[model samples]
Target: MTVYVDNARIPARVGRTSGRWSHLTADTVDELNAFAAELGLLPGWFQTCKRKCHSTLPCVHWHYDVTDKYRSAAIELGAQPIDIREMGALTTARRAALSARPKGPTP
Candidate 1:
């Protein structure tokens, strides 16, 4: 299923809840929440925390955590749903890119 969150497309309908919230970096959190509010999602849907990676902090992510039951509601406001398989392809490409990086010319 494809659901549009804040005008951006995302995946839905796999496990427990049909829809999965996409990652929203700190820079985009404010905008995402505002959009969520417009859609009528509860504040509990929002999540905030800095995950450590390479000693760098990439902005936090915000999610709506809505399920298939609530998907229609989101759609009413303009949330597009996407296929989960397609989403994995993106992750696979990112992983391949990360693995292709050079490591100081192994001797």
Candidate 2:
């Protein structure tokens, strides 16, 4: 299970917040959550795409929007830092693979 971070320069200027931020994603939600947990991010910080909010819609991906400091820490900890273009393709493939899986029986 690998975690990925986009190489897009920090977009700190666009947001009202004070620091740069980056998206942290993984091949699976469990992997993503675990990595975020290692980063000391709370469970509440986990975020999924809008589609993931509804059962009928395809779940795109799960991620954590992390600050620049955390971004550096993530990379140091073995997260693959990738180009923004590559990041898009990676996420697209991850989403497709995730959505194609068969669901277990509902409780």
Candidate 3:
């Protein structure tokens, strides 16, 4: 039930918009989405792999790219801060667990 944010020090120059950004993730999609909701993020802001060919890719992790301001808010709200190097392993484990679970009817 933990949410995670990377330690990336995003520079405003990285993107067209003038703000730092960080990647927000969790061990489960439900937890991730809930945290994002708590952060007042729009549902459309959620990012994941959409291509069928990439469905089995371990590199396809679910997350939200949040700005520095939002990152601070997320930390206040209990998102665990982690290094980018740690993300790959965390994401792989999470994705595996998610894939093994039985699917339920989509609401």
Candidate 4:
């Protein structure tokens, strides 16, 4: 699986602060999390299924919302630069990967 960093510097608010941010994703959650560690990101920073939403079903998106400074570091550390289309493709692949995994007993 390859790690990819997108060029989408969309204006987004993180907490009370607002800034342009990019996305860092991969074909699998494992690779994404691993690569994120190299950038000194916390595990809590990894984007996953939203806790509160209208739909009961989960949207399992595995990625990290990185700032411009982190974006540059990601690029320098060998993450493939991608466009919106490519980012979409990677997200699709990540969902598929999540789906193909074996399910555990329901709690």
Return whichever of 1 and 2 wins on TM-score. Answer: 2
Largest TM-score belongs to which candidate? Answer: 3
What are the RMSD figures for all models against the true structure?
8.8, 3.8, 4.3, 4.1
Q: How many angstroms is residue 96 displaced in model 1 relative to the true structure, after the best TM-score fit?
A: 13
lDDT of 4 by residue, 6-53 (tens): 999999998985888989987677888989999888899988765833
- In order of appearance, the predictions have TM-scores of 0.45, 0.75, 0.76, 0.74
Q: Where in model 4 is the C-alpha error above 4 Å?
A: 51-60, 96-107
Tens digit of per-residue lDDT, candidate 3, span 59-103: 447889888888889999999999988887787676677588768
- What lDDT would candidate 1 get against the real structure? 0.49
lDDT of 2 by residue, 25-78 (tens): 887789888888998988988977655543554666567888888889999989
User: Which regions of candidate 3 fall more than 4 Å away from where they truly are?
Assistant: 12-16, 52-60, 95-107
* Candidate 2 global Cα RMSD: 3.8
Please state the error at residue 20 of candidate 3 in Å.
Answer: 1.5
